[model samples]
Target: MSAGHTAVTTPQPRPVPVEEPVIRCETPQDECGVRDLLDRLGDKWSVYVLVELAAGVLRFKELQRRIPGPVSQRMLTLTVRRLERDGLVSRTVYPTVPPQVEYELTEMGHSMTHLVKALSDWSIAHRPAISDARRAYDEAHPA
Candidate 1:
């Protein structure tokens, strides 16, 4: 090469772009009964009942007392029936002089203890933020 001249290099070819297959993983509908199960769990009463059951079994009257104020007796009964139907809780009847009955968590219900505990932990951890939000919202709405 001459001192004053520069050599030009040819451009390299770009690699062909690979087209990856779009894998459609199974959705909730793909499972036989997952949608129904999710619907049951999504209920507020169901989660509350499960949380209450975590402490151990209780009679209907006891559950009525432990749950927050003003829950109707019919509502509690329905929640128990739903939980029992979903296989997450068990209802036991004691055939004594007065037929005592109790409700407790089944194996599946026991499994949900961690999830309930997590929700409780989160409520405690974010209490200040929740309080602030409530204050701001109430101030703006003036109810």
Candidate 2:
């Protein structure tokens, strides 16, 4: 109790609402298109390419070297071509005594890295549980 003194209340900030994403298949064409894209992005080599490109711009050989395992030149070329065709990657060619080419992610490709990283984190976190489940399933269905 003070002489003519009053307490003022502070305004509380509202929390941002989170919305669930919706993927609609209003037409057969839409479903087919989604599946086609999923197949392209979900293939064995594409994700590896994306992860490596996330580091920085790289030449074709550098990209090939960075990716682990015995990946064929043909396969890598095909993967990059597909990514570029999808507008997720850009290819630059420089002409000189010998031709030079470099590959980098487009804006769409950069945005997709977030989803890729999330998937990678999820796989790492759940690997142990997945291994346990596989082991249990194998034991139960011994043949």
Q: Which structure among the candidates has the greatest TM-score? A: 2
Q: What is the lDDT of candidate 2?
A: 0.88
Q: Give lDDT for model 1.
A: 0.83
In model 2, the Cα lDDT at residue 92 comes to 96
lDDT of 2 by residue, 17-124 (tens): 768646667777668467766876778799999999988899999999999998899999999999999888899999965789999999999998998888889999
- Model 1's number of clashes is 0
Error of model 1, residue 125, in angstroms: 1.9
TM-score of 1: 0.61
Error of 1 at 131 (Å): 4.5
Give the range of the ten consecutive residues with the poorest summed lDDT in model 1.
2-11
Q: Lowest-scoring 10 consecutive residues by lDDT in candidate 2? A: 2-11
Clash pairs, model 1 backbone: none
Please identify model 2 stretches exceeding 4 Å from their true place.
Answer: 1-37
